[model samples]
Target: MTDPLVSLPAFREAAAERLGAFAHTTVPDSPGSRRAGVVLCVVEHEGVPSVILIKRAYRGRNAGQWGLPGGRMDEGETPEEAALRELREELGLAVGPAEVLGRLDDFPAASGFSITPVVAAPSDPGPLRPSPDEVHSVHHVSLARLAADDTPRWVPQIDGGHLLQMRLRPDWVVHAPTGAMLWQFREVVLLGREARVADFLQPDWTRN
Candidate 1:
């Protein structure tokens, strides 16, 4: 028997209803900002709701970090379109626009990029093949793990706002903006908490 809380029907219903009800907050205007798109791809694996993440290739500014599969938006492309395209290019998963559930809060990276995270629930993500040039590995994180009350920790920040850090694996931990986004998804979509995490601070190492 599947866990009712992490079952596909409940995930879809909760995700759709909560995401549909909330109005997404966009990135604030900033000089020299570039637009980027990221996909919060959700799927059912072994009868549990899970989210996909990628360990970035050890090259870019955010090299070797676990984040969503996505990149900069192409010319004349919407955030939704870019998310789908990146998922295909990075993970070889082609999810159509119809599967897109909604958008989470826009995250502004310290790397001069304004990122929009698109939420989508694709039934089958196909055989995920990670692009060596972009992704080092892929992670399928179960929602049950994310919903645990002890999952996220409050780490003190220089600015007095506590930074959020969540464990993805025994040895792997992720922080905002990926951590913030994931926390928000768990709060609003999974538990319907109306929780907010954008104001959370990023670690000094990621503030490039």
Candidate 2:
């Protein structure tokens, strides 16, 4: 039997009712600020509502760190298009615009991009064929795990601000802006609460 808590019907219903009604915040792009889009690709895995993540190959500045399936938007592409394209390029999930559920806030990342996290569910959510050139590994984080009360933690930063951290595992933790994004997704989408993460500090530590 499928767990209704994590079933596709519930997910779709929540997005339609909550996400469609939630007034998501967006950051205005400033000069010199780049734009990127990330897909919060949700799926039903093992009867749990799960989201996809990628451990990037040791290739970029933040290589080997965890991320969603996305990249910087192309000149003519919308955020939704960029997100879906990246999902295809990096994870082989060729979902179209119809799969996009809604969007969360625009996180102004310390890394210089104003990132829009697009919530989506592939029509054929499946065994992801992650690109070897991009992803070191793929992970499915269950909403049940995310909704746990003790999942998010605040760690002191060198700058007197606090950085948000959450354990995907004791060994593999994700931090803001990814951590912030996930936390908001949990609060707003999963649990259907009003929450924002603009004040969450970007991480000061390396994933490794």
Q: On residues 98-134, what C-alpha lDDT tens digit does candidate 1 reach at each position?
A: 8898998888777667889988888766988889999
Quickly count the clashes in candidate 2.
Answer: 0
Stretches of candidate 2 above 4 Å error? 1-4, 158-160, 205-208
lDDT of 2 by residue, 1-208 (tens): 4442478767766776677988888788678878889999888787677888888898875788888889899999989898889888998887888878899998888888888998986658555788999999989898888888888888886778877888877876899878888999989888888999887877554422
Q: Which residue ranges in model 1 land beyond 4 Å of their true spot?
A: 1-4, 28-30
How far residue 5's Cα lies from its native spot in candidate 2, in Å, is: 3.6
TM-score of each: 0.93, 0.92
Clashing residue pairs found in predicted model 1: none
Residue 62 deviation, candidate 2, in Å? 1.8
